[model samples]
Target: MAKRGSRRATATRQQRNGKQEPPLAGWRLWLKRTLVWGTGLAVLALLFLGVAVVFAERSLPSYATLQATQPGQTIVVRARDGSELIELGPSYGQWLDPDQIPQPMKDAMVSVEDRRFYSHFGVDPIGLARAVYVWMTGDRRLGATSTITQQLARNLFLNSNRSLDRKLREGVLAMALELKFSKQEILALYLNKVYFGGGAYGIESASRKFFSHPATHLSVSESAIIAGLVKAPSRYSPTADVDAAVRRANVVLSLMREQGRISASEAAVDPSAVKLKKDTNQNSVRYFTDWALPQLEVLLPDTTEPIEVWTTLDPGMQNAASNAIKANVPKGAQGALVSLDRDGAILAMVGGTDYVTSNYNRATEAMRQPGSAWKLFVYLAALEAGYTPDDRVKDVPVTIDGWSPRNSGGSFAGEMDVRSAFAYSKNTVAAQLGNEVGFGTVASMAKRFGITTPISTYPSMVLGSSEVRVIEMTRAFAEISAGGFTVEPYGIVKVTTTGGQVLYQHEDTRKAQLVPDYVAAGMTDLLQTTVATGTGRAAQIGRPVAGKTGTTSSNKDGWFLGFSSGITTGVWMGRDDAKPVSGLHGGSAPARAFSAYMKVAVKDRPVEQFKTDLKLPEWQMEPDEEHMYGDPGDYYYIDEQGNLVEPNKPDQAGQMPFPPDSEQGSAPGNGQQPQQQPTPAPPSNGRPGDNPQAASDDFLNRATGRGGGTTQRTEPRQSGPRSVTIQPTPQN
Candidate 1:
């Protein structure tokens, strides 16, 4: 039987190879082998895919954790009344429920991001197939296959990385999210967690940022525009690129119409003509927030938790101060104004002309010469050394170590009381006073008052040659306003965590007495004369104010540092390069700016009188009546000519002919001509011999000395006389 079977097989095989068999027999065998190999390869691909899915699932976050994903919130800054000042860190606006989102906005997002959002189980099989086909075909569009839930999974769990591994991981996470949450929940999380441009973190913040309204108020066109920004927030941002945003919005609208979310007619909504709400908190409050940020770091160091900061900033005063600077500061010139309470609460601070143009906080960072404003410390040193405001000081030409410190106008009224000297901002008198109290004493006073800049013992130190920051000067002045108590200017009042836990609270703990009550009173009275009869007259706000005007040599910087009972303010104006501003003086722009700010700052506040009880000694009688200018009464009413007119005394018309107003511009202490004298001369006690003409010529020549006039030195025949002229003194 085996032999018979073998014979039959051979015969069949022969028949297959012969003409009697079908011609395609060999092709059938090849087709069977190809089928077997293809099936084996398909099973291997399935096994590899299953292994990749398992690995991706292991890499994903837990289901419970994914469902509970919440991004870190923004730090909220609030004004005193709980009104939002600004937000620090990435701001996430209010989160809305799934149904709270507008229908059009949701539809637009669905049409552009994922048309099969509702039908997909986190992963869209049909979309995935289409993507694969397109990718295999090398299509240029490179459309994404991720459903909205898949996008949410990537945004919430995965970082922005374009890799095959991340794609696989994202798919696994999307599946996990779909199992743990509903479609609406996924969409809500996606809308709330996606990052938008310009520091906006979510849909609501993006809506407010682009349209200046809540997400619920977004129109269909606006929704389309917003939806288009999801792919590339910076490139399609309406605020950043209007035309790009319009193109993107049109694309989104077309897609919406194609998806039947909107009709063709409705898709015609004009993106170019769309009304956008103006962005709020753009620059007005940025200055304050910028300043407050450092304080937050100091108050709460190395913190990642969202915090609420209650600041001492007065929004009303901030707006007013900012407006005053914008309105009053001259064009092309920048300005800084700072206001504070007696206890060092920063009320309002305008750091520069515009925070957008420059973030340099001139008010806090600029350390320019305080000019005569620095005299406060010098006089404070004098006061500490038992020098009274009425103590006599010579306002004469002074040459200390080859450096001749001339008065502003170069003309010096003979001897005057310390009060008048400071009020007038006499450079010579201040130099002499600083010398009498010892340079160390003056420097120590400055350090105690928060002046951190290096101070030289040079005679010019008394003339405010030492540079100082505006905030430093303001804080020092606050010490005087607070009855000689130390004041550390602070903005943040309290900080709390988002969970209602108090992190830090500011306390008025600076209780150490920096200046004695008596010294503070004397200083306040002396500075008051500066505003009352001195260079800071322009800063007078029809209230009991005390201040000083300071103009650096050549007008490089101008400052009006003043304080009332309730508030202390400092104003500074100068070019960034420290180049002299033409005709700029402390009393002109700074004093006027201080006045303008205070006018609105102290509105409706009851004016309180400054307490002046530190009794100053009586004025001394004139030593040389002929050479020395008369007392305050004698020169108080000088006319255009050098004639001194007795006030309300018609009979006493010509007691003594004074120098012309040109010789002695304004009062000694007013802002218009700070430290500006008509001439530089010898000491008050020593006069040039009996030649009155020589003295008069010397005064006029010295007054106009800056203008090509030459001066000659002449030694008095007498040896070691008390006073000496600009004429070279005897070398010894």
Candidate 2:
């Protein structure tokens, strides 16, 4: 019976493909099946790994290319005078021989990053096992699986994006690198390629960036601190956070002790006591370089070569602009400044108080309400419609389709010349002018002036309700300085490869005359009157200056656009969130930045006066209006004696000239002298504030007194009466 059953089973395993099969029993049969499946999988795995390796090898550069490759390439930016303003890419310090590398630094790096670096071949199995242990235990911080050699391979051959495919590729490269180079050679290469943050690449750059010394001069504490940065460069950067860096360095010291790289006594050295290099570039010119970087791609579309950029930036003016913005921009508020020549060369641009803290380039990127600064377009449009600056415009209250706009002081000065009304930034007058000239004409004027931002035709649009960039505003003012010719702001003088091949040279691209000469003269007369005795009086520099002051009704955005010393400058100040800033007024801080920056920026330039067909007669608000407005930031206010009084002039009344009865009119500083300190005054320019965001769509309602949302109030920190402001609420 058993023989018959075996025969039946054997019959099932009969011959196939003309080959007879022999029957096996128990473990033998199971072993045969296992061998077949295992061999197939092994062949597939080998094929997959081979293909991955081949793909990785194809992207690898030749040895010469690898040797020549910088962890990052640098672009040297030179100012107009050919002096170095800043280096635009990763900072690479002097290359060192293996002997020049300090032993302590090598020890710190190996101890913290890869203790088994020399014993293992690139991929450390022990470290990977620990990673597996960490993954299972849900302890992320304990798993640092990358070996030093693996890091070198990734830095040399890959990008920063993390993925499983990249990891597998990195592992293959690491193993190949181990075979091609000795342990010492790999370590040296790793040190030279790793990023150490603070714009630094390589160990040598890190040593100098943090310690202000070369790697050869580094002490054990400094070495450990620099070594600690590789794990998380920016977070552990001494320049960014000294406390965090010191804490990380302490951890590295403990690692060194565990690895026996340092004695217990040596590990006791206090890293916190180690003096680090101060950031010498607190006034970073990165603002200029950042603006110029993308332009290089446009200028040289075909080259991967590093280049030298000769910029229009004047180091002196850049320093001045940076200092002015930093000193004048109040705490919690941000400011941006752009200075351009009449031909539109950007001499200096400060995008914010500190580039290290926030890199949002407000000068070129932020599109906030220009306040009365936009009136440059409005008045220009009026001029285009044949109204002279001498023409009278009503400064009294006006209503347009149920939208009633009032003057800043809430008391209009009846009738005034167009220049005076503009000088005072009269919302009613500007709105009236827009209504007469046609909103389409206003939009056309803005477009002609290089303001590419979308302009709405609402009645309130005349009062800078539309948003524009600081650079665009400066360029528009520059065109006015250029006698009504269009000007486009340019920063790159030329871009050249390091080998002296010129790639791009800037040319005067546009000379289009948008407005007639008569209009330019009229606008100049108005701008001069503004600086001489209007809202922009704070910008006066004892010379022929033309400027305008613009403060949104919400006191959220302030602007000063002006021309002087053959240079046109625009300044903007506000919180990024569009929330109301306390005491923010165009006549105050923005003008102060313009003044501070221009005073030094044009100090060496020849003084030039504005060419005007008519002289602007100085005008002041009526005594009733002045008494009612009573803002220290106003250009001129009337005294009880009915005389024009300068609020900032101590000689006018032996003290500040603000109204004693009003809340915002208190005399500045001990009531003995007019304060030169830029006071945060009433930013309200009397028009309903620029509707921020979705609020913009509701501007018609808010301006016409239909619907409104709640306003965000910042506690008053500036020395002034609390600002009374109104605007359509912010949706962001």
Candidate 3:
């Protein structure tokens, strides 16, 4: 009994100890877990507070030191005499105050680019969160998650390269901008800095370029168009893709309506009614500008300001030059025209008939064979080689070092004066002159005339077989018109800063005398005679005109280069494929067009005189006179004294024989009296000369030299004895 009691007591004590230990172990575990979790939560809270402080500090504005470099801006083009031609810009970032920005444009941009732009402080946390979510979902690409202030900050201080580091930098800059500027100021900066396509950077330039109106007057539709361009300028450019632009513009309008910036009715605005008023020469003058820009750079070597180039382009003249070509040239025919002043200032230049068809400016870019136009250089060579206008040269077939040149008509004139040879466009005579003057002399003259191409000292050079640009040719001819002084064509007049400080001015310093004043005058006289009586007769104007007509051998090219007292003009007409123009010759097509254009070009200008003191050599007949008078039997020869010569009498003939008019009856003194010669019966059988009385009347009408004067007969009567009386016989 005593042992059992002791065992029971021990078992109970052990049980009690086990129960207490279980409760203590459970309490210890609960306390440890509570302390650990509470400490971890406190640490996380401190970390969050630190991150917020850093973000808040970053949101404060920070100032940066800029070198104050003037923005790269538009260059204005002016004429030499200080007339505005055009303005060109890569970015239209014109600075304007925030108040100047139209309310409609502002609201439209906000609605389209960032709806919560004004409410956000540079960084849009909600927008960023959304953007992150969208990125995480892989449904949208990452882009700027910033407000207007942030965008302005990026534009002002950040590089354009897109990268994570750049994004971080942009965010830092944006926060700095927000701290520095108020929402209104930041919005204004963004408005002025944003690009609006069409070479327009700011709202002001965008307004003017698109609507031809000021930014202050921009309407909802206009604002929407501008707002749409922010996403993809090229894709929504009104000039580049009108349809896509209209669609995007409508999206902007819809956004405005959705954002309560505009009424639903306003959002229904017809996009079709929107018309983009673009500059007349949007990018069409890029080549001309390119050519002019280098020159401007040279002229204003020290200029940091934008340059203003003034050209003498009469818009009327330029339009006429362009339109005339478009209207007259064939569908595929490419042509160019260059009009310039005597001082080598290019007034109007038509690079191609249609700039939209092809941008290959035939005027300044093409270096094709000048053909007979090249003869002008050859003539310059001849004059330089001591040959005069009256020098005689054989137009008969000739060969020079196995190279024989044929006349244009394929028939030779046998022999002709130098002037007659040039006027008549006798190829054989030109070739002979080239040989006489030595091809090297001609090439030298061409070089002096500004022909930069390599010229061969061969017989073909006489025919302008070498290639040259229309600009170079026009420049050369302008030197002739300017009385032998070589001139460099200039477009820019002066360069100035936006603050009206003069930066650079084009200096006309370099000049060279290519020929003597008299020589230039003599050449002008020859060209004038060409307009009056030569192949260039079609280029004649009421005023004093001098010009040369050129027709390539294969009729593949036609050119007319001429000058008035104040201006020199060059015209070229040919197929782009170099195919021959049918029934087209320089004397007809190009000359006629040149004459037409000059009539208007010189209408108000005073007539100028060419220098005329150049010495000319005396005329001398060739040694063999037989070849000159070979065809003496065909017609009656007469002396300068008006005395009739016997048939086959070459020695007494002072001038070439003249064929008698059919209405003048048979031979004189052949038993035919003037009154009884059957009235000189005209040609019959439906021929042009069928009407004898009509022919006589026509002759009588033309007989009067001046206006409305009666025809007078001036025949000398013989007072000598043995005056032979001839009986008159009537024809049936």
Tell me the TM-score of model 2.
Answer: 0.56
Q: State the local distance difference test value for candidate 1.
A: 0.72
Looking at candidate 3, the ten consecutive residues that score lowest on lDDT are 720-729
Candidate 2 residue lDDT tens string, 1-732? 999999877766664344566679799989999999999999999798667666665766665566567866578888988888877577788877677899998999998899999899779988898789888898756565889988999788765445788788788888777766778778888887788875788888888878877789999888888899888875577775676778898899999999888999888547556887877574558767877866775676555457788989988888899999989987799999999987788899998887766656799999999878888987876664435565555566667757888778798786666778888888887776676555666776787677788888787888889999889888988988988777888888988888998988888884766655656888998999999999988897877899998999789998998998789999999999899989999999989988988899888888897887832211111223234323444332322212222334344445445433233345445655333444322222223333211112233233323343223222211221111222211211
Q: Ten residues in a row with the worst lDDT in model 1?
A: 715-724
Error of 3 at 699 (Å): 38
Error of 2 at 329 (Å): 3.0
The runs of at least 3 residues in candidate 1 whose Cα sits more than 4 Å from the true structure, single-residue gaps closed, are 1-72, 89-280, 301-306, 497-500, 615-732
How many angstroms is residue 730 displaced in model 3 relative to the true structure, after the best TM-score fit? Answer: 68
Poorest lDDT segment (10 consecutive residues) of candidate 2 = 716-725
Model 2: lDDT to the true structure? 0.74
Q: Cα RMSD to native, each candidate?
A: 22.2, 18.6, 27.6
Candidate 1 lDDT, 1-732, residue by residue in tens: 999999899888888888455455588888987899999999998787666656655766664564456664478988866788877566678878889999998898899999888888778999989887998898876578878877887777665556789788788778766665678877878887777755787789989888888998988999898889888865676764567788898899999988888888888657556876644345656666667765564567445678899888888888888887787665567788888987788899888887645556788777899888988987886675445565555667766656678887779898667788888887877776665445555776788778888887665677888888888999989989988777888888898988888889899873656655667898998989999988888888888889989888888888898987589999888888888788789899888888888988788788889887764211111234243333333222323221222232223553333323545543334423334333312222222332111123333243323322223322221111111122211222
Winner by lDDT: 2
**Model 1: C-alpha RMSD to truth?**
22.2
Score each candidate by Cα lDDT. 0.72, 0.74, 0.65
What are the per-model numbers of colliding residue pairs?
Answer: 22, 0, 7
